[model samples]
Target chain A: MTNKAARNLFIFGSLFFFVIFLGLTVDTMNQIDGRAPEITKDVDAGKMVWQKYDCIGCHTILGNGSYFAPDMTKIVEQKPAGYLKQFLMDPRGVNPKAAMPKLGISSQEADQLLAFLTWISKVDTNGWPPKPILAAAASVAGQPQSRGQQVYQSQGCSACHSIKGIGGTSGPDLTKVGANGKDAEWHVKHLKDPHSVNPKSAMPAYGGVPEADLKELAAYLVTLK
Target chain B: MTVKYQSQKIAQYFYTFAIVLFLVQVLVGIIAAVQFINPDIFILNFNTIRTLHINALVVWLLAGLMGATYYVVPEESETEVWSLPLAKLQFWATVAAIGAVVLGYIWMGLDPQANKTVMGTQLLNEGREYIEAPRWADALIVVSVLLFLFNMFMTMLKTKKWTGIQGVLLGGLVFLALMYLPGMFYTKNMIKDQFWWWWVIHLWVEGSWEVIAGALLAFMLMKTIGAKREVLEKWMYIEVGFVLFTGILGTGHHYYFIGTPSYWKWVGGIFSSLEPVPLLLMVWDAFRTTREARNVTNKAGLFYTVAHAIFNFVGAGLWGIIHTLPQVNQWTHGTQITTAHGHLAFYGAYVLLVISMIYVTMPAIRGVTTYNQSRAYLAFWWMTISMVFIVLTITGAGMVQVYMERLMGLDYEAVKTVYNMWFWIIRAIFGVGFLIGTAIFVYDFFKIGKEPAPALAPAEQKA
Candidate 1:
């Protein structure tokens, strides 16, 4: 093969690879566009709040953002709308361990925020949060026990607590709590007002729980033992 | 002291070591492939099949790198290795490491209840638990790498000026030093453990070995094919550029689900998708140089070299692009597609290139010009054909697996049952082909230097 032939082959090959690349790029772009779930009007305002707060700057949604906050996408799916609204009203009410500062929105704004998060959860993230364990729990949203698992992972609950040989061992294990004494209703009342149960309890009250979310969350916690 | 004669002697030693280990690796590879056919084939059942795969790959590549280094260093330095005794020590240490790992696997198999230790402390132990190889084996492997590194670094330092090829060869060894980092941090957590393993596994195969392949292939072509040194050198430099360009960032692909940042998807996907660019340049350079050569000396070496170029282009370069795209990688990451890409790319491109260097240098080292080209050629063709079949089978299995596992949401067991039979059959068939190829090449190496030389010197005969 002469130099000329070699040069021609090189050029031709480059062109070929370039053409293949272009085709793949177009195909990928189309796939992304087609698969991306449309953002609904119901949650649009709430989503704007999420954006304005740069919620994703600290929190991941469907496994695509920061790790500083809970995975809000799954959280929305797992909790009731009223629970989310209450939490938005005062996250300290739900868990004092939350590092998230209260955004201090009104009842209406909090409701809108919950709607936005609910809409975000419905969007298809193409089965991200790739771990099978996490994905399974995420799929069973609104079931308290499953919701507990999501809450565990999302809120970095495992970072400070252990249950059933999983999660962080920093805090006391909660494995036998329900079996020991606390019933679902008692736990709900305690969660709504933890200091009422034990004046010296380190746990803070989750003031945001509307009645139904409180009921579901309590139901979920009851099964933990 | 004739430089060529000294180089040939070193090359002869490397040829012997390389062929022996090549056959050993092929045998281990067959066993590994068989395990995939029936995961319960081995009763010992200590380490997972993944351990077998990872260890075999590491050993095979180490042997190849040793061979390539032995052949190239003497020629580049225009001096014999400062001490053959040290070279021999390095080789034996490598052998010892391999033995230790094998024994570790066997011991773990027998004493399945032995407590698992992390960084020398008991982490977990059960009667049927997987036991990681004794830390001694890891230590020995690291020692072997260090010895090789010291020997090569010293040899290169003695050379007043470094050639472009030398730079790449040395750069590869330096990268090997970096491959040891992940093992330094032993962890009990599987997620953290796999994260670090990727550092070594992905970095070695996709990063450092690439530099070594490019350097050695170019160097061999220069000597055997009589390509212009300057042109080949320029190509080598460009090849290095391509390696670092994509390889450093391309590591993100392995981090996708390892509890790292989610942005790794975009970072790993985009950059790794471009990993083929340097490999493409390498394929181009290899072919162009071979074509430009006034005369090709060894038919077997030439064939294997060309095959290496083609496979690197298609297997490593093209097919790599197919699955490297973030979206595609998300689906195919741990599936058979990655396996197919790994086997063809690593064996065909990287391993074949090293073997090709051995083929080109064996007769030269023996001071013989022509001998048993037919056997080497036969081996090359056999391995090449088997590799193609293996790639085809795996790619088909991967596609089926992706559909079943992802699309149908079948559980892992169901997915494995669906694809395991056909995939394993193809793997076994390919294994047989590979064994035959390996045997032929090993036999040819012994026969070549022992046979009578042609009437004319090969250099004059070819030109």
Candidate 2:
């Protein structure tokens, strides 16, 4: 190509694509409120809290941040809101092994951040951050997890406790908890009120868990032996 | 060693500060890598460490580019910098900004939310990944950049002559400054925020930054290679044009999972997939130009040019296309896969270009024709090999992360802790090697031509 031709190509090509980009950007703005939930005042406040602590430095939200933490897009669905709030307030207190730092977030700010996260959870991400395939998580055991195990995961139990060398180390290892000779009744009481069995328990009460899920979780704990 | 204009010496100060920050960037990287293994151990915390690492790299690279422009523009335009004082003022302003960011991060305390007024008053971060700098810092940066740009423009304006290579550089600098403005725009919508955020981040790195890099590479090629100006200059226009044409639309890749519509899948994939075409031709162009070689004494300079071209193709182009297509990215979004691509592409495209500028420009600034390039060669090979290892290890970590966490239903924490720890250790080990190579390069840069020139003193003095 001649020099002038190359120059024309440069100017024209850039302008052409940039204009298209601008068009798509406008279209995206139009489609956004349709694709994702509307931003509430609480959600706006939540985004402020998200930025205040520099969460994206360690956490990926919308799959766009660093990989220091898990993706926050579907976190509201994966984790209980209460658990998330507490985790945000006191990361190590909630899960002693958590890599996150306590950003000194207040209860109000935690609520805002959670709201933002919830709003994010509803955003249509084009099927991104695909669900973890069961086969890979259970690949080591070569067996699908039991239903109670599913309940444990769904209930965010692993945020504080461990099972068979997996999960957090904040709470007792339930790998051999059945050997403790605790029956389901006692386990249920511990779930509802950890201080009932152990006066020094730092674990928060999981009383709000649905009674059925609580019962299933207690049943699963005794089977750890 | 023949100094064209006194203004070229102004670049030395910028390079000095930039090299220092580059060192800090490497040190912070080592710390971050170690923290990856055991997070609770560091007082800095992963957040602080990560912010520093990224922020330092960004500043150092920008400083390097700014310095490089000061060095190259005057010669290309056949005039002195229009305002040497402004160039020096920019250097000082940048240094202060770096200090404020580093100190504010370290001593600003962990509870920035509680100290909201303090953070805002002090002009600290708002926590976007590449753009954590607070609005105030952003403004300060904009002002300084404008001052720097104004100086460059005036210098170019002094001589009403334009080279294709210089024009690209000037255009890239203006684009660089303009792109920063988008990041300043705030939106209540998370998707909208990210969409605009990528405009600043992706557009700068993939679009404007690439143009600047192409111009720098062209400048070096012209200096060290026997290729005709028109041939190299034409290649410049083509590559830069393709960069923007494909790159502007290619930003849809970031848009795909950020709450944008599904049309981005096709728009992003097609455009981004075609990005490698220009890059591949760039690699071929570098080869074609190099084959028509002159008796180039500046071997290190040539090495960096060719290497930048090849790696720009491999790192940014090849690795990028690997996941740019939506099907593959479906599994890899936000995974370590992105990390692998980011490191390789940044180091290859920008970092190498910066180092090459120092290699090619510094010797003349220091008036050293007898440059002992043996140490430079050592540093180059060491860093190059170490970078390959670093990238491989990270890529290994990324693969395992994709397979275990995304593919498998493993807990995210378990995938990071149980699976990726070993790779992190390997990456940190090679991180040390990369640091050593950088140190050698910096040290060698100072000692480049301490040896006296050959005995042609009569002709030199007579002139």
Highest DockQ model number: 2
TM-score of chain A of 1: 0.51
- RMSD to true structure for each model, in Å: 14.9, 3.3
For candidate 2, the per-residue lDDT at B11 reads 87
Write the residue-wise lDDT of candidate 2 on B1-463 in tens digits: 5559989989889888888988898898999989888887677778888888988988989999999999988998999999887788888987897798778777644546433644333246777888888777888899999999989899989997799988999999999999999999667788888888998998999999999988887888887765788888999999899889899999988887888999999999999999888788788888988998856766788888888888888899988998898988888889888898988898888888898898888878888654677787888787888888888988888889888777755567877888788999999999999999999988987787777544544533332
Residue range B1-463, candidate 1, lDDT tens digits: 1226363365555556556656766776676667555544665331333344445555666676786787678688776676678878877777676766666555544453233445443222111111233455556667877887787777777764677777668877787677766655444332344445666666777777887887887887877777876777766766765676677667777666544445567867887888888888877887777777665657667777777777877887787888877667666655678768877887766777877777777777666666657777787788888878888888887788666554544334344544457777777888899789878877877887687655655565845
lDDT of 2 by residue, A89-189 (tens): 88777667777777788899999988899889888888877766665446456667787777887777775566765664545667899889889889899
Instruction: Give the C-alpha lDDT of model 1.
Output: 0.62
Question: Which candidate gets the maximum lDDT versus the true structure?
Answer: 2
- Model 1 pairs whose backbones collide: A86-A208, A93-A205, A93-A206, A93-A207, A94-A206
Best TM-score among the predictions, by candidate number = 2
Query: Which residue pairs show backbone clashes in model 2?
Result: A46-A112, A136-B408, A137-B409
The models' CA-based lDDT, in order, is 0.62, 0.83
Q: Quote the positional error of residue B12 for candidate 1 in Å.
A: 4.1
